[model samples]
Target chain A: MSTAAATHDDHHDHHHAPTGLKRWLFSTNHKDIGTLYLWFSFAMFLAGGFMAMVIRAELLEPGMQFVDPEFFNQMTTVHGLIMVFGAVMPATVGLANWMIPLMIGAPDMALPRMNNWSFWILPFAFAILIGSVIMSAFGDGNPSAPNFGWTFYAPLSTKYGPDSTDLFILSVHMMGISSIMGAINVVVTVFNMRAPGMTLMKMPLFVWTWLITAFLLIAVIPVLAGAVTMMLTDRHFGTSFFDAAGGGDPVLFQHVFWFFGHPEVYIMILPSFGIVSAIIPAFARKPLFGYASMVYATASIALLSFVVWAHHMFTVGMPLAGTLFFMYMTMLISVPTGVKVFNWVATMWRGSMSFELPMKWAIAFVVLFTCGGLSGLMLAITPVDFQYHDTYFVVAHFHYVLVTGAIFSIFAAAYYWLPKWSGVMPNKTLGELHFWNSLISANLLFFPMHFVGLAGMPRRYADYALQFADYNFWISIGGFWFGLSQLLFLAVAVLCAMKKGEKAAAKPWDGAEGLEWEVPSPAPFHTYDTPPVVK
Target chain B: MSEKQLSVEERNKRTLKKLLIWAVAMFGFAFLMVPFYNVICDITGLNGKTSSTAATDVPEQVVADRTVTVEFITQKGDGISGEFTSETKRVKVHPGEITLVHFYASNPTSTDMITQSIPSVTPGEAARYLHKTQCFCFDQQTLAAGERKDMPMIFYLDPEIPRHINQFTLSYTIFDVTERVAGKNNSVAVN
Candidate 1:
């Protein structure tokens, strides 16, 4: 260990600050790894967004103009894969890598070498996935991609999957491995490497949330590994895990997958909760209300996640007792989630709140996330789920939680910390403009999906009935606007990175407090060569 | 310094002890998850128990005498295909013999075709079979153009089936396999 540390020190100073392409390829710094994650996530976001637009365009009119049914299925599947794995997860990990050490006053990630390995594995995983999609173009059968949806239900996954399903399986395995490693590093770092005075309770909410999220990741990723492994064996090794012909149950796959998947949804959003908690207080000029309750609430939500897996399979013919159990369990999640929302609002209530870009995004998150939460509650009822299952309603519910709830919080965190990272405050006018457009357009995009879903339109279909055509058209319009609005975000970020914006103070936000704020603006290439004591 | 103040070395030592304890605790916690999962599975009866084995064991002779039904549906909503034959041969049964029936599907399409979909076949019941498998119907098949394929399905009829009826009819439907589209031309052709 000492030799490894010595080698790290020797190379750390002289590493040319890693210039151009090679920096991203062979970098070992936590910040560089974070940057890689962020950039890759953004690229995947665009790719996934593009697929969504195609889906919307096809659904724009009753008839499919742009794509065929099989292709539409592929779009939905890949879009989901990219967004969940490629966009949201990577973005959250990036934020963790960048913020966790700084917030805890650590020099760097506890396992920097492992961090590099985790990031490096992602490109390869995505390459295989993207390559599989490309391979389908030459195949003779459907000329479409894996349309079984991202859940890749058995029978469909096993019997109907593309020839490249093997590749997809391998890709998912690699990504899962990367996530587990990244999560382990986070757990070790937060628990082992905190500076003096930074007790678990005293640690920043972001660190706490990440610690919890890491635990959830470690617990659930292996289940995903198990589920996909079943898929692989069923497909190749003729296993009966999901094969009814051989006495296997297809719905069991749903049980195992969602067991991993439900927590995964929390894993994506929980850190956002931490980010919003941190930002809301700083802007509101108040100490966060019910801080300990907020922690307990987060724990409650994570604990409840395991019991709610069957909620996703409600329509798949679950027994009445099982359905009722899942419904109550899912509803219980809302109590903690509601506590979080109420705390955010209470923290902001009647304080000297200022609407900076980060604050704007945070405020929007509170309102929008609540709306998402309400829809989640609606879906929690077994009877209501019967009406909403597999409909645009489910789509609307998750997009609200994920896009506005999780992704928006990420935007807020990026803006909140941008000055510290780049030495320049992002252009305020453009930032605010981007915020309002995104907030409004995002709502416009996902809010109506509830109605479309309720009106009895199934999700993941290429074409819909004439009744759904109007709503889908409007949704498409909103989606396009939302996609365009992201360009503004990119512009602002690039401008700030190039130092074309206002210079910022080390502590740009007045109410900001933390070891991170005590450091110089734009933080040095290497920060806290000696760890700082936290109070 | 106050009497309560600790020396820097002492503080460092305390921190190290705390960290070591945390590491050990975490490792112990992680180590317990597997056993904990197994316990939960055992309680829930989800410990990968083969559904058939969990139920009363049907005699192999009875399983052999039973006739299984297979139905196929189309993806384009075209319903069943032309006079689809059950892939399994008929079983001979004595009076009052309960036996498992097996069936399968063959796709004869110029293009690679997946059976639209099939419903599950289980044991017992007259019109429908009780499903002991954890999943629904057969795996989707991707047959190449002009390829002949056979997909096998297994099931059993209760002894009561003979009292209620003498013969069973099995049906199947075929559908043109579809492709998955991502963005514009970004598509994955299903095999």
Candidate 2:
């Protein structure tokens, strides 16, 4: 591979090198599209985070202080919709686009044009969502967006939802279409485009986890599409799918939504498993213990997701037999999940572990995510769920898994891979400071919620009795601090992106392995144009 | 040529084979969803017709000398003004078969009140095989302050309903709807 040959292999056979706005609008370059996804998701994160702050501010005391109840509902609903669809999912997709090809030694994603379409659809979908919120601000029919919790259960959604609900439905439909397309592209890239010698077992764990996550996304996203479509028809078409007045059951909506929702929870976390698997090894200076078992465990979790959906609906009038069945099925997920956690700890056991910023987040993720998992297991018991069903405990449980588990892993990945992407090592001191503040405050924010929940405080309550006031006060204080701590991450990320940091080597992490390391720092515009021989 | 080049082609073929396996797997998955969906619907009773709607689907009929008494009882813990003291007003019957009852309830409080639970009634207790179907009791209701709304309870005295008859009562209890609060000053109202 001479220099000229390498440049030709990289640059030749390339599509038009569009510049400026057109490059983003009409281009299909994987790296450009990836950057677009990263930036877009970051923007959505800020917007969703703002909504969270509003929610925390409202909950600070109990009674409403700033916004009306209807407006508050919109904030909560839109916040969830945006964070899950706009921020987290796109962030994961961005990482996959940037790293998967390099990791597996492929030139680019297999379906490049489809990739552009997937990214492009997101802006329009979010536009519709934001547009609906703006529309609700006007006093047209109901001056409120969807007040139904993000779950959008029936009867309430069908009978009492605002006119803006129609727009929310359209926005969701668009988002679902975008996600399915993205998932398809990922599946094709991982399955069809790996370089020679990169067998399934030989591929990096990140790629393997992504492959499984893609399948889960593809399988369950359509079910969500179906659920939302039913909601649309029930709202507008007078269809009785969720209306008891016309031969429908409200609880039926929960059955359908959670069927998709439970798998969705895994879709968010499975990739975090991949991120941790990658990071723990590098920091610990060892090969990931039980790599094959980790892959199998992820697959099992994905498969188990479909059966355990009813766990979310245990208190919704299910028979004793059904309740017990769901309880046991839900608990069984821990076996595979526990296998993954054990393997990670074993990989770290006795290894020369260094607490780099990325490693700090990874180590924290394992401990905090296990806390969430244990709580989840506690909720899985039928008799216990009757008490915990709609409490802040459930809220605490999920946020622990999502924010601490999924979001922390994302931060770890950003620190781990920023050097590779930016050609500069991030300021380590600032990175560590961000990690410590986030880790401590995030626990301060969510840890007390478990006790509040156990103390008989129901979730989704605007006001509480005096008994819950103490924990609520602390939780709100923690939330505001957690919210502010994110600014440090944003500052560090911006500084690194602007190249105001130390120059980095191609392989900065000594134990880091994968074809991704074969490229130079700040991986070239076209990586592995002539795909590497994987061996 | 290196042995590796030949093996690359062999591996591509293997990849294609695996892809075929996945495609077949996806196909089997698509095939399974319909039956699985139906199974879930059956298990959850999501597909079952609401009692009211089921009543309407029955063939319209007229009958003679079928006498049935319909009683509406408020659930034990309910404190709504209409629950115990409110007048039953008028019970209009079509005589031979079907009858429709329009019930009105008022909430004296400024805040909204929700009907949390409805008591189930045995058919025989209501009208002795006179089909007692299609009632507002099937679903919970939320009433606003000083709100007087008419809820329809439609039923037919299944000529057979009276034959199996003994007694039946519809009862409801009112509670407060929960509200969701986010951080300070941001609260979403939920029912």
Report the C-alpha lDDT of model 2 over A348-416, residue by residue, as the tens digit.
Answer: 999999988889999999999999999999999989888998898998999999999999998999999
Please state the CAPRI-style docking class of candidate 1.
incorrect
- lDDT values, one for every candidate: 0.74, 0.75
Quote the B-chain TM-score, candidate 2: 0.48
The TM-score obtained for chain B by all candidates, in the order given, is 0.37, 0.48
Q: After superposition, how far is residue A55 of candidate 1 from its true place, in Å?
A: 1.2
Residue B90 lDDT, candidate 1, scale 0-100: 55
lDDT of 1 by residue, B1-191 (tens): 65237543344345445544543453344334434543443344332221232224453445445443433222222322323444345555442344344333344445554443434221112333232222223444555555544445444444444354454433333433333111214421111
Where does candidate 2 chain A have its weakest 10-residue lDDT segment? Answer: A1-10
**Candidate 2 Cα errors over 4 Å, as ranges:** A1-16, A135-142, B1-191
State the lDDT of candidate 1 residue by residue for A77-102, as single tens digits: 99899999999999999999988888
